[model samples]
Every structure is written in structure tokens, then in C-alpha cells.
Target: MIHLFLGGARSGKSSLAEALCHRWPGQVVYVATARSHPSMAERIELHRRRRPQSWHCVEEPLALARLLAEAGEDQLLLIDCLTLWLTNQMMAGACLDQATEGLIGALSACRAEVVLVSTEVGQGLIPDDPMSRAFVVAAGELHQGIARVADRVSFCQAGHPIPVKGERP
Candidate 1:
């Protein structure tokens, strides 16, 4: 099953995803897409501390499709956030269309249950800059695409989750 969680910053989407993963019976693998930077050190540490040591962690900013395709049926995959992956792809000038297509295909073929976390960045004011506007549009479109393929979707606000599709988990 593909489960998607969307929310603004600090809205507890990651926490909700983690909680679900903890309920899974098999191994849990955390696929982290965030690039390490000094400014993000504390935030990263907090997440690291929160997750159980038994769960394996893989830091892959790109090539998520490959990882997903390789996962076994005995595992549950939790991708903490897609926004950072998108940002990395944009910064590297990767072909977004191809990447998104590959991701969708991989998700379709994946054997393990997957949980995806992403920021809902399109609800705020319109950005004055072209790049920011483009990012917002891309993120909104990405969310829509994922939602279409996902078995379950939830929106988090103020640390509360509201089910958008499927039953509340």
C-alpha cells in the first residue's frame, strides 16, 4: 500500500508516518532524502533520535526508484520527505518528468508497503520570484500525482491528521 502524508512545516506529518511504520510487523527502512548541511544538523539529529535504532536508515537524495524496486516484501519503507528530494533534483538540473515517471513506476512495482511524507507548499501566498513560483507549482502537481496513485492520503495541520482518502490509520 502507498500511504501519503502531506502538511506544512512542523505539522507532524513525519511523526505520523513514523508512528504508522512502528506498527508494521516487519523490518522498517527509513529512506532519508535530506542532504546534510550545518544549518540542518540539529533538525536531523532530532529525527535520528526519535527513530528506533533497530530501523535501518539510508540516505539517498536521488535514485529513490532504484531503492524502492529493490525493497523486499518483508520490509516497510518510510520516505521522510519528497520536497527535499525534489529540491535536490531541481538543483542538479535533473529531468523532472523522467524522475517523476520513474518514481511512479517504481511505486507501482514495489513489494513493500510504503509511506511518503511531503510538504503542502501551495496553500500560502504566491511567491514574487519565478523559481519559487515554479517550485510551488511543481510541488502541487507532484502531490496530486502521488495522491492519484496512493491508497491512502492524509493532511496534517497543527499536529492533527485528517484523512483525505481511505480509512484513518
Candidate 2:
């Protein structure tokens, strides 16, 4: 089953995703999508501290679909945010069209339970710059497409999750 967790900044989406990962019976891979930077060191450490040592961690900023294919059916993969992945792909000049479509295909073909974390960034004010606007629009498009294919979709706000589709877990 594919689960999509959507939320704003500091809205407990990661915590909820981790809880779900902990409940999974088989191997769980925490696929962190954030790129390591000095400014993000503390944040990354906090997340690392939250996860159990038994769970494997893979830091992949892009090429998530390829990683998903590598994970196979026996393991459950929790991708802790598509927002950063998209940004990295965009910055790296990857073919967004092919990348997003490939992701959907890879996800549909996967037998493993996949949990995707994403931030809902379209609800805020319109950005004045083209790059910022492009990011928002791209993110919105990606979320909608992923949500359609996801078995479960939930919105998180203030540490609470409200199911938008499928069964609550």
C-alpha cells in the first residue's frame, strides 16, 4: 500500500510517519530526502535521534524512484519528504516530466508498502519570484498525482492527522 502524508512545516508528519514505520512487521528503510548542509545539521540530527538504530537509513536527495525499485517487496520504505527531492531535482536540471512519471510507474509496480512525506506548500501567499512560484506549482502538481495513486492520503495539522482517502492507519 502507498501512503501519502501531507502537512506544513513542524506539523508532526514525520513523527506520524515514523510511528507507522515502527509498526511495520518487516524491514523498514528510512529514506531521507534532505541534502546535508551545515545549516540543517541540527535538524538532521534530531530526526536521526528519533529513529531506531535497527532501521536502515538511506539519504537520497533525488532518484527516489530508483531507490524504491531497489527496496523490493520485502521491505517497507518511508520517504521522509518529496519536497526536498523535487527541489533537488529541479536544481539539478533533471527532466521533471520523466522523473515524476517514472516515480509513479515505479511506485505502482512496487509490492512494498510505501509511505511518502510531503509538505503542502500551496496554501500560503503567492510568491513574487518566478522560481518560487514554479516550485509551488510543481509541488502542487506532484502532490495531486501522487495522491491519486496512493492507497491512503492524510493531512496533518498541529500534530493531528485527518484521513483524506482510504482507511486510517
Candidate 3:
């Protein structure tokens, strides 16, 4: 089964995703997409502290589709933040459409149950900067594509989740 969690930053999206992971009967694998940076050390540490020690953590800055394709049947994966993953690929000069297609294809073939978290960035004002505008466009497209395939979808606001496309958790 595929589930998607969407929210603004610090809106308890990760916390809700982790809770769902804990409920899964299979082994939980957290596929972290953020790259470590000096400025993000504190935020990263917070996430580290939030996750249970029993869960296996994989820090993957790119090649998410490849990783998904390799998932074992006994695994349940929580891909924390697709926006960051998209950003990582975009900054690396990858073609956005091709990358997104590869990801959707890989996800369709994945054996494990999966849950994804992503920021809902397109709801806000348009950015003046070109790169930021591009990011929002990419994010919007990615979210829509995933939502089409997702078994469940929830939108978070003020730490509360309102079901969008399926049964509420």
C-alpha cells in the first residue's frame, strides 16, 4: 500500500508519518533524503532523536527510485520529504520530467508498503526568484503524480491531519 502525507514545514508531518510506520507489521525503513549540511545539523539531529532506534535509517540524497525498486517484501518504507529529494535531483542538473517518471515507475514496482511525506509549497505566494519558482512547479507536479497513485492522502495543518483522498488515519 502507498500512503502520502502532505503539510507545511513543522506541521507535524514527519511525526504522523512515523506513527504510521510504527503501526505497520513489517520492518520499518526510513529513507531520509536530506543531505547533511552544517546549517541543518540541529534540524537533522531533531529528526534523529524523533525516530525510534529500532527503525533502520538510510540517508539517500538522490537515486530514490533505484532504492525503491530494491525494497524487500518484508520492508515498510517511509520516504521523508519528496520535496527535498526533488530538490536534490534538480540541483544535480537532472531532467525533472524524466526523474519524476522514473520514480513513478519504480514506485509502481516496489514490493514493500510505502509512505511518503512532502511539503505543500504551492499554496503560498509565487516566489520572485526563478529557482524558487521552478522548485514550486516541480513540487506541485510531483505531489499530483504521487497523489494519483497513493492509496491514502492527508493534508496537515497545525498538527492535525485532514484526509484528502482516502480514509483518515
TM-score of each: 0.97, 0.97, 0.97
As for model 1, its CA RMSD to the true structure in angstroms is 0.8
Query: If the candidates were sorted by their lDDT against the true structure, best first, what order would they fall in?
Result: 1, 3, 2
Find the candidate with the highest lDDT and give its number: 1
Clashes (backbone N, CA, C under 3 Å), per candidate, total 0, 0, 0
lDDT for each candidate structure: 0.92, 0.90, 0.91
Candidate 1 contains a number of clashing pairs equal to 0
Give the per-residue lDDT of model 1 (tens digit) for 1-169: 9999999999999999999999998899999999999988998999999999999999999989999999999999999789998888889998777788788889989999999999999999999998898888888877888898999999999888899999897
Clashing pairs in 1: none
TM-score of 3: 0.97
Candidate 2 versus the native: TM-score? 0.97
